[model samples]
Target: MTVTASARAASPLLDLVRPARPTHVVDVGANPIDGDPPYRGMLAAGLCRVTGFEPQPDALDELKRRKGPHETYLPDALGDGGTHTLHVAATSGMTSLFRPDTNRLGLFNGFSEWGRVREEVQISTRRLDDVEEVDAFDLLKIDIQGAELMVFEGGRRKLAEAVAVHTEVSFVPLYENQPVFGDVDQELRGQGFIPHAFAAVKRWPIAPVVFGGDFRQARHQLLEADVVYVRDFGHPESMTDEQLKQLALVAHHVYDSTDLAYHCLSQLSLRGLAVPDAPNRFLAVLGSANRT
Candidate 1:
């Protein structure tokens, strides 16, 4: 059996199962053409429109080269309103908005070997408080390496504006002075975001994890898979059963390997759908179909 191929492959059955889930997303740490081409097809489905921000010159250029309709690009880092120079990492993937020591804390050490250590390059920053308007956002992904907190601090108002948040978290110290998971989680919760779900580490959907939990085992990883958070949106406990199921489906994809219960509970805020009585019924159907 094969994974069902659909227009929205990361979430296929979801649209058919429940077509109302918000698809507009904002990607914070979009690296050029790196990992997942961050916002490509989402724009195609008429379910997306995104503002992708990246600080590295090369990556920013690549983002420009690869952009299309419904997508906008910003060459600034997301943080409090100010100007700051970033210590650009030698390599593209390694390039971050922070100091080099932080790279050493991540699970991958390849950046340490790339070797070019340079002075801070001037970059403009923005605070979310300064953001006068954000119409709506279904999802907001923040992967700005170790400076995620700075972005979070600046985007306090925008955080409240979004429906869900996806930020990468490294349990170990990847940067010399970056906050740990505890700090990040507290910051998220402070802004009314809850740890909605988890996604495992993978370059793409095609690359499966053959080993056990990398986040649980990797020594100094830059980021484990992205951690997702959902906004309470003033009605934390209000959701239809179908919306709950749809959310569970997303949770399954996010933390694809984790238990089903978490996958189900994560969709606590979905708007219009019925809650199926026996949650496992749909799971059993999908599971049995996969075996065929």
Candidate 2:
């Protein structure tokens, strides 16, 4: 599942239409356990720079060891800048600030074993706004198990300038007092971000029920998913020309949302802000990529 930048088709149009500066990305809870990130293509093309935060010692070590020149990794646990207990689970990916809800996890198969608490470590968190290393960024990608709301509440100032957000949203709360999808969605909307798409949708089968000889196969229970949100594209007049261009680059390079990228370019073109025929050139490049 390690997707490299080479997997994507080459497009010279991206080179011509990319922003003057590299897109800045801030990644919270950046554990490589999830495989390659969505911005891998941009990173490989030298079109973006990443600043990642990981609290776990082993995970932080791995990130630093393999980081690129433009990539920076910090060992800061990000939240509302308060002290909290980190519930280390049997599986690293399951570790979270909030304790696991064993009763609820038992309702689904495989999760109970994965979410079992192995240890608890007291730690201090740093608010995103307080981090001096992160001055400003164009995109934010966060996945901190269940404490996503705390970051949003404390990082409003930093998030205001971001063009897009890629965050993990839970349909069902696996941790005690965890905020679900609706909670995160409302907060992002209040911050002027609109839901764009769901990059991943995870489902788990109910316990003690086997479906078609596959015990791990899910029948109809939604667990969690990675959701992408972007600043209101419908009102291009409200956004700056730089914001529009950055959004187009993010949409095309990160999410492969060609239509959305084209719409962004189209708005810039109408205002005489973009290069001549930028939208059409984008479509042509996409068409050629698809054919190859």
Give the candidate number with the greatest TM-score: 2
For candidate 1, give the lDDT.
0.57
Please give, for residues 72-134, the per-residue lDDT of candidate 1 as tens digits: 777767787777767665655545555667345332433345434555677878775564444
The residue ranges of model 1 lying beyond 4 angstroms of the native Cα positions read 1-22, 32-34, 37-41, 102-109, 132-134, 202-225, 232-292
Poorest lDDT segment (10 consecutive residues) of candidate 1: 202-211
Clashing pairs in 2: none
Give the lDDT of residue 33 in candidate 1.
37
Q: What is the lDDT of residue 282 in candidate 1?
A: 48
The Cα local distance difference test for each model comes to: 0.57, 0.87
Best by lDDT: 2
lDDT of 2 by residue, 162-255 (tens): 8999999999999999999999999999998999999999888888898888878996799999999999987877887778878988998899
What is the RMSD, in Å, between candidate 1 and the native fold over all Cα? 7.7
